[model samples]
Target: MKIVLASASQFRKRALDMLGVPYEICPSRIDEKAIRDNDPASLTRKLAEEKARKVASEHLDAVVVSGDAVVSKAGRIYEKPRNLAEAAQFLRELSGGEFQFVTALAVMHSQTRRMLSTVEVSDISFRPLAEGEIQSYIEKYSVLNYAGAFESDAVLFFADRICGSYNFVTALPVSRLIVFLRAQGIKI
Candidate 1:
């Protein structure tokens, strides 16, 4: 079957590429800010499904894969930071603490109009970061493009511990995606 990725995120694309699948990029241009919920998992699932459905509508012959991620700490949900200042603040608040990185992946078979979705949650622990460190990191990388303002691999030096799939923390959970694809009779 034809494969289409319903997102523009390089991180998600890279994760999918690991499966050696030939897919086309068709970004689902949806207003993400309009979709929100008190529960992070539900919010991410909704966003992922919406993105997949949006792309699937255009490509009825392809299977559309889309995903969304959010960070939750102390009952507050965080999406990609709106600006550098917010990114810095997110890092500061997450310093020396634990947070949940929740990622939702959705695959829609347009012809069948069937979708399989899953949410992966990872617990991340951070070492205490000074204000200067946070500022330096932000200036050096494009944190505003990633949820939680920090990439898992990029922030490994300051991340004390991770309690789940590292790929999920990066935004796309590849293992889960593989399972979903296999269930749909797609060979990875």
Candidate 2:
């Protein structure tokens, strides 16, 4: 059976490539903003499943995989910033504090509609950052593409501590994804 990745995110694509599985990219066309849930875990899980289902519908013979992630602190969720200003603000707010990084992964056997989903939560803490530091980081990287303005480059220098899988922070959690794919009878 063929495999399909249900997202346009380069981060996810890069992570999936590590498995060495040949797959096609078929980004889901769902309106993510329309999906609402008070709980962070539920929100990410639903989004992940929805993306997989949306793509699976178009490729019934293939295994469709999808994922969604968010960075939250004190219950407020932070998605990708709209511009440099918001990116800088996000960095400032996340600095000197620990936040929850939630990643939800889903795999669907389109032929059978069998779906497996899991969530990985990581605690990330950043040391206090100065205004100049935040400004410098924002100017140096394209932080608009990632949640909490956390580009991959920021992971090493900005984050003071990480309590979970680094893959969850940078992209999809491949270890968990490997198990999900195997259960769907797809050899990685």
Candidate 3:
């Protein structure tokens, strides 16, 4: 079966590449900001499902994979930052605190109309960050492009601890994806 990824995220693409699976990119052009839910997990899953469904409609013969992520802390769900200032704010708020980094994945087989979905939650603790460190991180990497305004790999120095699948925290949750795909008769 043909495989397609319904996202434009470089992190997700890199995760898929690590799986050694051949796939095509068909970015789902959905207005992500329009989708909202009070629960972070539910919101991420909804977004993932929507993205997969949208791409599946256009590629009826392909199995489309899509995912979404959010950082939840103190009852607030943080998605990608809008700008550098927002990124800095997010980092500052998260400094020296533990937060849940939740990610959801959806895989749809358009022909069979079968779908598999799962959510992975990871706890991440950040060391107390100074204003200068936050600013330096923002200037060094594309922090505004990532949920929570930080990337695990890029912010290793600032991350005090991470408990869960590092891959999931990074965004793709490939281990879970592999299991789900295998159950659907897809060899990766």
Candidate 4:
């Protein structure tokens, strides 16, 4: 089966590539910021499902994999940082604190009326960061593209502890994806 990755996230693409899966990239164009009044966990699943369905509507011969994440501290949801100021704020809120990275994945095949959704949770503890360090990293990485305003692989924002799959926190759960694909007979 032809595979379609319904997102533009480089990290997720890399994960699929590492497994030698040949897929097409078709980033969904839903206005995610417009979603409100839903819980973080629910939102993650809904967005993934929405993206998968949107792409599935256009392609009948492929299985589309889509995912979304929400970084939650207490109960507030942290999306991709809009600017340096918001990025800094996200860093501060997560400083020396443990938060949950909730990622949801959706696999859809329009031909079979088959759709699957999964949520993987990763606990991340941020190291205590200095103001200067935050600013420096923000300047270097340009936080417009990263969710929660940080990257685990980047030196400036390292997680002291992680309790779940690292790839899930990065926004794609590979093992789960494989399982989902197999369930649909879509060999990855």
Candidate 5:
């Protein structure tokens, strides 16, 4: 069966690469900012499903996969930062605090319209961060590309703890995806 990934995210692409299976990248052109929900889970799930469905419609014979990720803390939801300043601000807010990283995946079989949606949440705690450290991190990495201004491997630097799979923080959850593909009769 043909496989399609409905996102332009490098992180998700890298995760999918782990499967060692051929897939096509067909990013959804949907306006993501137009969709909003107070609940993080609902927001991510909807975005992922919408992306998958859009791409599926274009490739009727392929299985389309898509995902979305967000970080929520103190009732605030954070998506990818728009610029360096916003990235720094997000990192500041996440400093010395606990946040929930929510990632949702949607898989659709375009031919039959069979779909599956799943959500994963990771509890992350960051140690107290100083101004210099945050500045240094911003300079060293492209923080704007990641939700909450941090990457999965950032846990090795200043994160105090992580309570879920690293791939969840990266926004892909490959192990779960493997199971989903297997259930669809696709051999990886």
Candidate 6:
């Protein structure tokens, strides 16, 4: 089946690549706040639905995929930091703290607009980070690329350990997505 990745995230692209499935990016431009009130699972599902809908409306016979991943801590949702200062703040808040990452995946058909979803949770343990380290990491790795300003550069040292899919922490859960694609006979 033809699949469209309703996101331009490199992390998500990489995740899909791991599954050996072919997909194309088609980021959704929906107002995320419109469905923020929903719980973690529903929030992701709705976001995915909206995103996939955006692309599906313009395509035919394709299943569009959309997702939203977040770092939830102390009831606060941490998304990708916009700049170095905010990225530093995000790292500071996460320093020596343990937090959970919720990666939500959605698959919607192009013709029927039907949807299916899955939420994958991953835990990350942050190491004690110094101010200089955070600043340097931001300058070097660019947190704007990921939720919570995380990257695979030297900044990964900030994580002392991780439980669950490290890939999920980045945003997309390849393992869970594979199952969904397989169920749909996508040959993932």
- Backbone clash pairs for candidate 4 read none
Clashes of each: 0, 0, 0, 0, 0, 0
Model 6 agreement with the true structure over 1-188: per-residue lDDT tens digits: 68888888877778777777677777887777666743665666667667877888877778787788777778778877877788889889989899877778887777766777877777888889999888888887857867777865533687787787655534766667777776665775
Q: Name the runs in model 5 displaced over 4 angstroms.
A: none
- lDDT value for candidate 2? 0.87
TM-score of each candidate structure, all chains considered together:
0.96, 0.95, 0.95, 0.93, 0.95, 0.88
Per residue, candidate 2 scores C-alpha lDDT tens digits across 26-145 of 999799899988788899999999999999999989999899888889989988899999999998899999998888999999999999998888898989999998999988887887
Q: How high is the CA lDDT of each candidate model?
A: 0.88, 0.87, 0.87, 0.82, 0.88, 0.75
Error of 2 at 162 (Å): 0.8
Q: Tell me the tens digit of each residue's lDDT in model 5 across 1-188.
A: 89999988888988788789899999998999999999999999999999999999999888888999999999999998999999889989999999999999888888888888888988889999999998999999878878888886676787898897665544878888988877766787
Return the number of clashes found in candidate 6. 0
Better of 2 and 4 by TM-score: 2
Q: Model 3 — TM-score against the truth?
A: 0.95
Q: Which ten residues in a row have the lowest lDDT in candidate 4?
A: 150-159
Off by over 4 Å in 6: 152-155
Error of 2 at 122 (Å): 0.8
Q: What lDDT does candidate 5 reach at residue 5?
A: 93
Model 5 poorest 10 in a row by lDDT:
164-173
Model 1, residue 18: C-alpha shift (Å): 0.7
lDDT of 6 at 142: 59
